[model samples]
Target: MQLPILAYGHDILRKQCDEIDPSYPGLDKLIDNMWETMYGANGCGLAAPQVNVPVRLFVVDSKSTHDRMDEVIREDHFVREDTGIVETFINANILDESDDAWIDEEGCLSIPALTERVKRPWSITIEYFNRQFEKQTKTFYGTTARMIQHEYDHTEGVLYLDYLKPLTRKLLHGKLEKIAKGQIKAKYPMQFVK
Candidate 1:
């Protein structure tokens, strides 16, 4: 089942998500649904908070992004040969971030119709539990790493909009207000602040 994504004005998106263990109720089902919801919305990543669940859980599939790219674009976009991974991350922690940074346009399932150019590390070393609940540590690079960072920030109560220039955010305030007022149309179901 595809869950309704919570919109920007919702309070849950601003909370620090708690880490979850395998014992968490409906763990497997939630992860599966998240993937469905994400793919249905054409999003490369989805965080639990975006679904109104404030927990250190999220799903990502950068391969979905790669498959859509032209070969020439792919060559310029992917910095790592591995390209990406499709995985469910639980209780994730960023161990280290590479000094190099890249600016990329990103959009969120929760904040529909808004895309921002955000600066993020080109690579990251992280530790997290996989869907099987096995702890794993790995370094991810390029767009894959960018997707992970975006989803990870959601668990930390951060939004890509927060990284925008102050003037840029101010200029977009009116559109943001419309989104918060539930006046925007999205391809998927969304729950907005009342």
Candidate 2:
């Protein structure tokens, strides 16, 4: 079943998610539904908080252009196809010790009408658990890396706008107010027509 996505200003979206229970009832199914939601919404990533499920879980399915292999590989190392797609991360723990961070434009599923360039790490090595409760380590860089960090922020009750400068925030204040009112919607509407 597709879960109702929490819009901007929803208290749940600002609340930190709880650690997921591997054996919890319907946990796997919930993740599946979230994947559907994310794909249906054309989102690069989706967090439990966005789905109103306050659990430490999120789904990241690589799009054709935002492919993980392209971002994870450099001149030498490579990644296998099976390692991407339908990615599920539970109890995600990110190591933000990297001194290398950059700025880029980002959008959120909940806050749809606007996009902003925010400062974020260009690379990350995150440790998380799959739906089967198996531990996994995934490294990301470039756009994919920025995305991982973006969704990971949701798990911690952080929004992309929070990283914006005060001047930028003021410049977009009107649109942000509309978002806070849930009056704005994504220009490209998302539906499960396929």
Candidate 3:
């Protein structure tokens, strides 16, 4: 089932998520539903917090932008999944170590109807888990890496707005307030912020 996405000002989005335990009932289903919910909402990533569930679980897909898997191989680095979807990270550690820069427009599910430009590292290495509860690590650079960083931040109670410039926040403050007040409805209300 696609869960109702919580909007801005909701406390759940700001709360740090708990680690996922594989033994938990409905864990697999939750992951499936998260992806369904994410894809349905036109989002590339979705954290458990967005669904009002504070679990250290999130989904990510970043294949088109970052093709730097070769670099990690060159460094004799460890490899994980062929398809990049960091399903559940009990504790995710992200390292920013890439020079290739790119500025990208980003949107959030909580702060619906607002797309802001945020500066992010083009590449990163993330250590996390797969659906089967196995440990894994991978390096990504470009848009894919940005997606991972964005979603991981959600697990820590960080919002994209926190990273936005003051001017950007000021411009969207009124609309975001309206969104919070339900005074205006976004034509495309986001269900996943990352």
* Alpha-carbon lDDT, every model: 0.91, 0.72, 0.71
In candidate 1, clashing pairs total 0
Q: Could you tell me which 10 consecutive residues in candidate 2 have the lowest summed lDDT?
A: 74-83
Clashes of each: 0, 0, 2
Winner by lDDT: 1
lDDT per residue for candidate 1 within 1-194, as digits (tens), equals 99999998888898999999889999999999999999988889999999989999999999878888888877756864766689999999999999999898999988899898999998999999999999999999888999999999999999999999999999989988889889996989999778
Model 1: runs farther than 4 Å from truth? Answer: none
Query: Per-residue lDDT for 105 in model 1?
Result: 90
Predicted candidate 2 versus true structure: per-residue lDDT over 69-162, tens digit per residue: 4544422221233333457788989864357776666888888867887877656788999878999887766656667777888899988988
For 123-155, candidate 3 gives per-residue lDDT tens digits of 788887778888778787655677777888899
Q: Per-prediction RMSD in angstroms?
A: 0.9, 5.0, 5.9
Better of 1 and 2 by TM-score: 1
**Model 3, CA-based lDDT:** 0.71
Cα shift from native, residue 32, model 1 (Å): 1.0
